[model samples]
Target: MSTIYKSEAGASEIQRRYREALRAWPVPAEHIHVPTRQGETFVIASGPEQAPPVLLLHGSGANATMWRNDVTTWSRHFRVYAVDLIGEPGLSAPSRPPLDSDAYALWLDDVLEALAITSAPIVGISLGGWMALDYATRRPDRVTRLALMCPGGVGRTKSAWLFKAVLLRLFGRRGIRRSARSVAGLEKLQDQSVLDDLVLTFTQFKPRPAQLPRFSGDALRRLTLPMQVTVGDRDALFDSADTAQRIRQCVPHATVRLLPGVGHSIFDQTDSILAFLRA
Candidate 1:
């Protein structure tokens, strides 16, 4: 919808490019659309049908393609379902229900029921991490394990980067690229294609302005399942230190990794996440 994109043309272009990316999915995958109260939700299902299921939830403004680098390795051992979160720049509907409501958890319930999955491990990043926490805490009996990368809700969201991003946008495309790289912590990354994709995405995508609701200590203490959190020390979006501290204080049993020089968009975490999922 226009609410999610700058214009109709941008929406069409984003979807067209998304379809192009899906065609070149690293591993063999089946494109699926599950019906939910919100609308049709898109998912990329991979790995053997008999393998244990592992759900993957990417951050805001990203689709299942965010998992392209890791899916090949992860799918080797588990049935991977990379879901396109609603209201994001994915093939899913642009329906954004209130974050304070039960809409997301219910939508996930529909997805799980449709997939015939009783319980499964979940891997989430940034915004997806918040949603994963929301669902797991509400439906604890349904989640086997949790792996979060720079997840929101547990951390204090920052506003400094946003102000800088806004200023950088005034300088044109070059400035926008700088803002994207800095925000994503991709400054040292050698992957030009990844940066290119990031630039293209932000140029047309209208990111959700609402900040994720921080999880209360009471809500976090309810998670007793196997949990692992990895965040970068240099993250500009969320307070990585606060996230680490809360998880430690609330869920002592959870494994926490605070990377020295990571940002909001963490990459090359395939093996670490796979180990957590398989553990």
Candidate 2:
């Protein structure tokens, strides 16, 4: 499979840091590899074997370890599977599937099948949220509940801002840090190690140069599963108001929350998210 890193050395360094982060995960977990039509999928499984299943998906430029803060609590009540999305900076295969195709849904199906999970609740962040939404639209039967945090695809992305951010990144570390803050609307990152890893990935890794495909109103309407959506009012990518408005308009039964003063990162709302999952 094709790799996403710019060089073999860069890929190795990022993998090393990722492994270090995984070692610090609060809960005991098992790493598993499942073969899929697209590629090999990596997953971090935790919690009791008999507990109800909950699938967790991380955002772009991230891996399963992004759930470190939430996993400890979440694993207590449910069997948690944090999946490393294919083609990203994770242990998963480096196969970049077409965003406009059903490849992601199919890959997810393979993951569930390998784990022997018929149906379960799914929680996703940013691009991962978009992936979960895409899968739910294609196979609603496999998703019992869906929760999205600052998900893409619900509203149009601001291409001009993204372009500016990319240009800023080319200047150097300061420029990259500025771009990161602009995209996330955060003055300071909660975790320094996560920020360091993200910086390395952005500077050294070769990311897929593709934007998320917007979901049509008809597609959103077909998502009948119980759903909860949350976005930051200050999100720099998509218009938060438009995102919530679209979900409310298309999915009438869906619940939406707009966090004030928040940005792209939604890790702080773990308590409420856990409550939603339990409910």
- lDDT values of the candidates? 0.92, 0.89
Q: Each model's TM-score?
A: 0.98, 0.96
TM-score of 2: 0.96
lDDT, candidate 2, 125-178, per-residue tens: 999999999999999999999989999999768666678788997888989877
Q: Write the per-residue lDDT of candidate 1 for residues 1-279, one digit (tens) a residue.
A: 468888788889888888898999999999889999989999999999999999999998899899998999998999999999999989998999999889999999999998999999999999999999999999999999999999999989999999999899999999989999999988998888778778877888888878899999999999999999999999999999999999999999999999997888788899998888877
Model 2 lDDT, residue 93, Cα: 92
- Point out where model 1 deviates above 4 Å: none
lDDT of 2: 0.89
Error of 1 at 206 (Å): 1.3
